[model samples]
Target chain A: MNSSFRVTALLLCMGPLVSVLAEPVPDLTATLKAAFTDKRQATLDRLDQDETQKLCTQLRDQVPTSELSQKITRMNLATVKPPADGKYLGDWKAGEVVASTGTGLQSSDDPAKPNGGNCYACHELAPTEMAYGTLGPSLKHYGKLRGQDPAVLAYAWSMVYNSNSYAPCSNMPRFGHRGILTEQQMKDVMAYLFDAASPVNQ
Target chain B: MSVQDRYISLVAACTLLGASLSLPAEQTSEEAIAEYHAMFGDENPAELWQLRGEELWKTPRGSRQVSLEACDLGKGPGVIAGAYAELPRWFEDTGKVQDLESRLVTCMTNLQGLPESEVLAVKFGDGEQKSELEAITAYVAAASRGSRITIPLDHAAEKAAYALGESVFFYRAGPHDFACATCHSESGKRIRLQTLPQLTTSEGAQAAYTRWPAYRVSQGELRTMEWRLQDCLRQQRLPQLTYGSDVAIGLTMYLARNANGGEMAAPSIKR
Candidate 1:
């Protein structure tokens, strides 16, 4: 047999082997897009992950390296926008409402209604509320423990704006940064944490 | 009494008081929740759905006027014993990896000649409206009671499905930046009063996966695994997960595979 004929036979033998060896990786992006549909308040675009989220997802249960963690924190911290009017506190009563209420941006939620902080879902905000979660530490006496200094107030504001700023990959939602809570609502939540008369302080 | 005798009696009384104080210390919240669930005992409402499902399975219906007795659940036709424990497998006829719900859709459409739309119309049950799929899932899952979970991942498709599921579990997106891992990757964590299972570990996966297709007391409905995934996504503030979608099957495959060697105990009662 000629050299060309032998080469053709070799190529034919290797083709099926290569195909068998190369397992097809499912197109997850396409699969995810196809798997869900747009609903009220929640659209298909919500599935799109930002850089920080993508990195966190890649890490999964594993802790990120300190450098990577700091990078994420810095990226998220940049998104935190302090109150424009320089007022860090709002009505404590309204803040209490925001902290307790859990409905907001959910598919079933009405878009017209204001969003809630849902702080009690992962925190012990007040001593009276019996059904607080243990995922986060008890912030029972937040303001009482940390005095009302400008630096402390700024830290609290930034923390709520983007929890990843302090603890990267925190379970807490980025209320201000993600548009889950408005500037007024976040101010109210801050009051709930800092106001001397608020239940959180008591 | 003598001074020595009085001193000894005082010490004994103090010891008794300490023991009594320690004996009835308050129960942890987890213990309390478990006790509350146990109070229901054999009064699981899922039994009603299971009965309805069994009837649906045996009775002849649809355009073909055939019962689901001839339907194959990865254990040949008409065999339901321990079938669910080995599900989310590769199906030759459909050429896809399917969970219990998706596989039923196929059988209902192909064997019974029911329209796919009609079969999938009601994925979940509401107060007045009932879902036939949820009922059927209860019946099928019950059949596998005490059977060990054994997702072999032997087929290439099954492996692919498992991989997709792993990615889905870890993929964080949406407004809250939450994935299944956010709440479920840690041990002894709670979201409000509810105790979350750490599904990353085998113990957590087995404990959680085996008790699905439960009668949710809060909703007054029997919920299937598919319903669980759908609701979870909704709570995550993400788009609505389509019924019987690939992501749903993939997630189920991942959870079920992690629960390998665990005994099935489905159609259980839940809060």
Candidate 2:
């Protein structure tokens, strides 16, 4: 198991049960198949599930043994790669654009064009941006609150790269791990989070 | 803005002043709701997002000078359908955990070769840039509609994230002292005509969580579930949440787990 998984296994072993079983379970997979018909710029192949996904599906959110959770977490953690230049911070202004862009990864995109982060979909970052969402946590003081500890920076990096690495079923996109953000973009986003000048700290 | 209210007020004022103040009455709330639906129709704009997402999946652009057909959606590169259902899972090739959006970005940058910074520069939910993400998300969600949400939360990091997410959900802030739970933890609350679902309850949370990437009639755009949650915070008079923050995902995980078995109704229409 990767280090992350080992740590998760240890942590979950000590934590309370986290699962919340869904009731009145519909024939979810079948419903998915039936509801989604292959169309232009959309397709049916996305309906399939992987092995780990199946297990997670079966368990819903009640995580099984802590060790197993760690195994999974660590395995994913191994995937993160720091920037080529070894810098984790970027221009938060540019990062704001990355955070805002919610494009790419679909049939609608030129495919030749780049993708956006759609960060506002879940995060509350800057104070001035009136239109925002709350599905995620408010990051208004991300930098000011978290401080620039190496652990904090790394953790943030990992969270942006692959939130699932830290939370198996996390809803946030793995900006770096998933390749949604470039090293520079990741740095820019990092700046948006850590830089005192960024609005997130205002 | 009710037609009947306008008519009544006009009639009363005219009667008081003894002047004819005849005008087209405004629509009733029910009529207005119906008008909204009629204006909205069954066809969600999100469908357009799904359509465009598919195009982006194949067409060649970006610095890589290659089409995304070779990129994997967890099924394998170029695999479109059903890939999203199993996401937030670990991938060894990249050696990192990824969600649908992040993975798609990987494909776009690696295979397409768009400057990651340029692509990341776009805004969320508006402008030309946000539209791309919406279309792609709609398409991806459409790809996995009906599939179970199975995010592996076993990683130590994943576990930590859950801890973080759980903590974040209970966190309250803003001038009015708001938390996600403030409106969602309890059942059956609303601002005006809008019924707020109780997210603390499994049944209500699932209902709220499952029906996202929804077409918003009010905004005239297709928004993902993420947008739904973030917008709620904004309405609560809180700070603007940046795109893709950890606490957001943690909170989302909390909600997702609660809504696990709800059939995916993504790309659904909303008011």
Fnat of every candidate, listed in order: 0.68, 0.00
Residues B1-271, candidate 2, lDDT per residue (tens digit)? 5544543443343233222111112322234336445643554456556767788766888866777789787787667676665655556777665556666667777778877676556535563346566677788888777877665666655555455445445443332223555456544444223456766565786677667777654455678655665566554333444444554555566666666556776776555
Q: Spell out the clash pairs found in candidate 1.
A: none
Flag regions of model 2 displaced more than 4 Å: A1-202, B1-41, B93-96, B125-130
Model 2 lDDT, full chain set: 0.60
Model 1, span B1-271: residue lDDT tens: 6544543453344334334332322433355436545643465567777888999999898999999999999999988899999998999999999999999999999999999999998889885788989988899999999999998888988887877888888888998998998888777888777789877667788889999988765566789999999899999999999888889998998899887888999987665
lDDT of 2 at A180: 55
Per-prediction DockQ: 0.32, 0.02
> How far out, in Å, is residue B164 in model 1?
0.6
Global lDDT scores for all candidate models:
0.83, 0.60
lDDT tens digits, residues A1-202, model 1?
A: 6545654664453221111122333555567989999998799989988888889887766666678888999998999898999999999899999988888999999989998888887899878887788889899989999988999999999999999988888888888889999999999989999999988888
- Model 2 quality (TM-score): 0.49
Identify the candidate with maximal TM-score.
1
